[model samples]
Target: MKRLIATFVTAFLTCAAPVTAAELGDDGLHKTDWMRDTFKDLPEDLAEANAEGKRLLLIMEQRGCIYCDKMHAEVFPDPKVRQAIEENYFVVQLNLHGDIEITDFDGETLSEKAAARKWGILFTPTMIFLPEEVPEGATAAQAAVATMPGAFGKGTTFDLLTWVAEQRYLTDPEEDFQRYHARMIVERNNGNTE
Candidate 1:
């Protein structure tokens, strides 16, 4: 009975503790086990994400952006946030100034920087959440269900990801992201966070 109680305590603590994160890559990006290293093709990545039962997430960041640093160091390291991303999303990182080739959902191929410009991504640490079924000839930015610009606190970030994963944007279009996040904040303060 003592051992059983100890096991229960351990399990609870493990579940309650914040998750540690992976090391930063040489590219100055946090490298998680869940991030995919692909050819930067949106359609192919979408197909792969679908096959893995995950949503395709495109995250843009620069090498020296402090907001990116904050996200990798603070927000993403939270266990609940990390778990939500790892379990429900296949992330692909894009360097804001990189010259690497990227194929867009609309079949346009361009460098990472060019794509960023085309997509009107003017901020570092922008997270673009794509819908499962993108219409033909739509650009990735055009097909995105939601876009998170700049770094946010852990709670907001987690709630945004959760909203996207649950497809709340589609079903609760009237609620919107702001309303959902506002409700989440209230719920958290009320002790039902999650």
Candidate 2:
């Protein structure tokens, strides 16, 4: 009887626990199973993503960044958002202040910090979505289709992922990300019990 009660208590605790978040690495960055471990070469990364039929997504973050922490804790752990990212994007994490070397698509080699500067990344958790094919002599900043500069809710994050994955920015010029997001929000609310 005691064993049964203990087992029930454990199960209740487990069921009531919050969604599991990513673990922090030694670099103080959150590590996710969907993120790819790569050599940080932009062209090679894009090629690999293309080979796998996925878009290349460069995620810029820094240690001790609150917004980045929020994203890793709340938004990324959402099942739909996680699935969208895993299925559509080859995510490569770049530390905004790290010393690790990175090779850009334009043949410029620089440290992660320098690359962030080169890309004009002014915010932590900047997400740069790239096209499958880059124009000759184009840097990553010049080639990016969309850039998300801050942490957002799961809905916005998921919409951005979906927009980029579906290539809506290229095909649906009349409807921008904001418009699409607004429509999605209304549609979602339509189904809400409230």
Candidate 3:
């Protein structure tokens, strides 16, 4: 009887534990399997993403950021978000304040911090989504199709990824992301029973 109780208690606790989406790096940032460890060169990264038949996604985050933590723990850990990111995006993580060198697409070389400043990134958890075809001599910030500036809930994040992956921004200009997200929210709510 004692053995059965112990086994049941352990199983209950295990079932209730949250899933971990990624591990933490020494840089104090969450490291996921979906993220690439590239040379931080925008052009090269884009090319690599293209070669892999994936979209280039630049994720800018800072250390000890509560929002970033929330994204890592709450958002990214969700299976839908993780699978969408892994399957459709070649993610690259950049520190908002790090000094690592990065070569922008326009042939300008700058540190990650400089690039963030130039791109007007003032917040943690900024996601920059690039188009497949970029014009010559255009910087990454100049060519980005969409940018998410903060952490969002699972459904929003999933919709954003799906929208970008489907290239709906170009095809459906009348139904913008906000409208699409609202529609999706209603559809999801209608499908839920509890």
Each prediction's TM-score against the native?
A: 0.86, 0.88, 0.88
Off by over 4 Å in 1: 1-22, 191-194
C-alpha displacement of 75 in model 2, angstroms?
0.4
Q: Which pairs of residues collide in candidate 1? A: none
Q: Is candidate 1 or 3 superior in lDDT? A: 3
Residue-wise C-alpha lDDT for candidate 1, range 37-111, written one tens digit per residue: 999999999999999999999999888788887888789879999899999999999988999899999999999
- lDDT (C-alpha, whole model) for all candidates: 0.91, 0.93, 0.92
| TM value for model 3 | 0.88
Model 1 TM-score?
0.86
Model 2: how far residue 143 lies from native, Å: 0.5
- What clash count goes with each model? 0, 0, 0
lDDT of 3 by residue, 1-194 (tens): 99999999999998898545667798888898888999998889999999999999999999888889889989997999999999999999999999999999899999999999999999999999999988999988889988999999999999999999999999999989999898888888996635
| CA error at residue 185 for candidate 3, angstroms | 0.6
| Steric clash pairs (candidate 2) | none
Cα TM-score of candidate 2:
0.88
